[model samples]
Target chain A: MKSAVIVFPGSNCDRDAQVALRQITGQEPAMVWHTESDLPKVDLVVLPGGFSYGDYLRCGAMASHSNVMKAVKDHAEQGGLLLGICNGFQILVESHLLPGAMLTNKKLKFISRNVHLKVENRDTPFSKSITGETIRIPIANHDGCYFADDATLDQLEQNGQVVFRYCDETGAVNDNANVNGSLRNIAGICNDRKNVLGMMPHPERAVDTYHGGTDGAELFKSMVEALA
Target chain B: MKARVHITLKNGVLDPQGKAVHNALKSLGFEGVDDVRQGKYIELQLEDSLPEDQAEEKVKQMCEKLLANTVIENFDIEIA
Candidate 1:
């Protein structure tokens, strides 16, 4: 499947997403800068992680209104696949592509480590190929706490929009395993349409064996299969 | 005209930084502190030609659009 990765000014993971996509899709994904008003026609659009706009005016607030976001919104509206990782997830929430907001991590510190995530809703296009119920991914950020009102959380749960949740190695979600204090241990969520996904963990970063294990490779493979 | 905006997290939203500050204050032996919440104060300069009412309105709009994240924050604007 063809894809394009959005590159904001401070995006440090654009190349990671590109590398993962190239490995999975067998072609280079276009790197679209935030200043550009349009996106290349592709099956999937990715907003990779980084402190866009230097995290000013809230984490993703400024980058949410960047020039290229108009097209990203358009792409989501067209039912095209869209994925946001880490700070990209922050931008999606700031953009209202997904519900909830990110706050400072509960401990008031940045968390950088490997965390186990249960595939809460694998029926979506992003996780359809994962043959297992859990995956290990790396999360690195200070403001990764997910927050939303009770009503919104309930709605998302009822609609099956929550795609991943922090869990133990045995796939048990418990309060202690909640890395960033996201409500209900949420690690990733998709919009009601299921085409847009915003996740805190960097699946791209986990796609290479050299980094660790290739547990994240299935997510990329899932998207390719769904898009195909 | 100059406008100042106070952006604060909304009620019921967890403020980890504020909690941390509160802990620090308590650690420093300030027992009288009831509760502490932290927020941001942003100042913007407006054109001199703009009327006071218009400037306040514009700043309010700015708060709604960008200065404040309405989902998690509340903003108060004052123009001078």
Candidate 2:
């Protein structure tokens, strides 16, 4: 499937996302800069993780207002696929493409490690190909804690928009398994339409067996198949 | 003209940074510190010729649109 990855100033993970997408799709995805007002025709738009704009003025706040975000919003409104990982997730929230906001980790420290994630909902394009119930992915961020007001959280739950939640190795969700103090242990969520996904885990970091496990590759494969 | 805006997390929202600072203060033997809440202070220089009311309105709009994320934070603006 055709894809594109948006690059902003201080986007350190853009190249890593590009390499992962190229390996999976067997074609180089377009690298759209933050200043561009338009994006090339593509099936999916991936926002990679990084401290965009140096994480100044809140994470993703500045990048959300970049010129390229207009096109990104349009793409999502049109129901084209969009996946935002880590800091990319923060951008989606800041852009209002998704609900809720990210807060500093409850422990007030940056967390970088491999954690277990439960596939809470598999109906969305981002997680449709998963054959297993849970997966292990690397999560690396300081402001990864997910938070939303009570009414919004209720709405997300009622709409089945929560796609992933932190869990133990055996796939049991508990407070101890929640590395970050995310509300309800949310690790990923989709927009109401299920076309846009935002998550804090770094799936690209685990897309290859050489990296450790190939669980992350399954997510990419699922998206490619769903588009096809 | 100049304006100063203070942006702070809304009440009931978790403030880990503020809590950490409160802990540090208690460790330093500061007494009667019932609570500690962190916020941002931003100063802006505006057109001097603009009327006071207009400048205040503009700064309010700026805070609503960009300076403060109303979803989790609230902002107060002061003009001088």
Candidate 3:
């Protein structure tokens, strides 16, 4: 159940992930900086959200080329579980650990609010504990809209790689609930091996009662139980 | 030598920022604008004394590797 959270220069959510991991897993996770060329052995590696490299060139472009991404990619290649939340998701895609890319929000505005996500699949280690339900998590970003080609999208859907989809509180996927205008309401997806997951929502920001929700706690617990 | 790279979203990809600009142009009374797509232009100064063809190829390699994300972007390289 050991985990490490990657902290880039502009990552604002590293501590949030750290606190959430510690509170949920009952162990202090390592805070790995982006410059480190290697990672200590850990069960999971998290890419937290923030304006890495001040979102220059692209949201996760500069951070993806950082020294630590090599280790992160190696970790995923070894079947180690990797999770990228928000900007972390951007980094994963930029690193090609996951498919697709992010684009500006459909309305050209930064959105910060809680949105319901339907659990599309629970077969992976990250969501094994989650039963069929809609969970609320906070999303805050300007470039959260996910885009991929039609063929790739079809494959993702057919292979069950889509793990999460934006949905209404009633557990129905609809345009009204797709605040970011992501294609097909896709909020998150896993790699072909299902060892890597990238999502725009901030589960770490919703893991405590003080945060007004604990829906994200089960995800961390699921990973720990599956790995440990 | 200088390598200029232009990265643009591929066809069929949505461009919200471009759409916003298009709408703004319409509001500003600009007509005959069929469409708009936003992109990035990067200029790189090479330190090597290579031929234009070789340097262009090198910049193209750079574009494929880092300058552009081939998934949703198309990069055009110009050498000067």
Candidate 3, A83: how far from true, in Å?
Answer: 0.3
In terms of docking quality, model 3 is high
lDDT against the true structure, each candidate? 0.93, 0.93, 0.92
Error of 3 at A108 (Å): 0.6
Evaluated on chain B only, what are the TM-scores of all the candidate structures, in order?
Answer: 0.96, 0.97, 0.93
DockQ winner between candidates 1 and 3: 1
Model 3 TM: 0.98
All DockQ scores: 0.90, 0.81, 0.83
**Candidate 1 deviant stretches above 4 angstroms:** none
lDDT of 1 by residue, B1-80 (tens): 89999999999999888888999999999899877889999999899999999999999998888888888999999889
Pairs with backbone N, CA or C atoms under 3 Å apart (clashes), candidate 1:
none
Model 3 / residue B53 / CA error / Å: 1.1
On the 0 to 100 scale, the lDDT of residue B73 in model 3 is: 96
Query: Where is the poorest 10-residue window by lDDT in model 2 chain A?
Result: A206-215
